[model samples]
Target: MPYITVKMLEGRTEEQKRNLVEKVTDAVSETTGAPKEKVVVFIEEMSKNHYGIAGKRVSDQ
Candidate 1:
């Protein structure tokens, strides 16, 4: 089994997330010879304030 964790800023559409999971699962299955059903994808969405660059919050950029 292959497990993938994807972290990104919040506000992605449901369709985008679904497509990402499907693509990631396919990639893992193809590379590791794992079954598609055995590939697990976890998406964690964080607020813009949770991420910063140059001491400025992402939301402010």
Candidate 2:
């Protein structure tokens, strides 16, 4: 089994996330020769306040 985690700022439509998972699963399965059912995709969403860049929080920008 292959496990994948994707972290990004929160605020995407359900459809977008669904598509992302589908595409990622397909790519992983194709490259690693893992079955689609055996490939796991995890989505981690964070708020702007929890994300930082250039020594500053995104929520502060």
The C-alpha stretches of model 1 lying farther than 4 A from their native spots are: none
Alpha carbon lDDT of residue 26, candidate 2?
Answer: 100
Q: Report every candidate's CA lDDT.
A: 0.95, 0.98
Give the 10-residue window scoring lowest on summed lDDT in candidate 2.
5-14
Model 1: lDDT equals 0.95
- Predicted structure with the largest lDDT when compared to the true one: 2
Model 1: lowest-lDDT 10 consecutive positions: 1-10
Residue 39, model 2: lDDT of 98
Candidate 2: regions farther than 4 A off? none
lDDT of 1 by residue, 16-56 (tens): 99999999999999999999989999999999989998999
User: Which residue pairs overlap in candidate 2's backbone?
Assistant: none
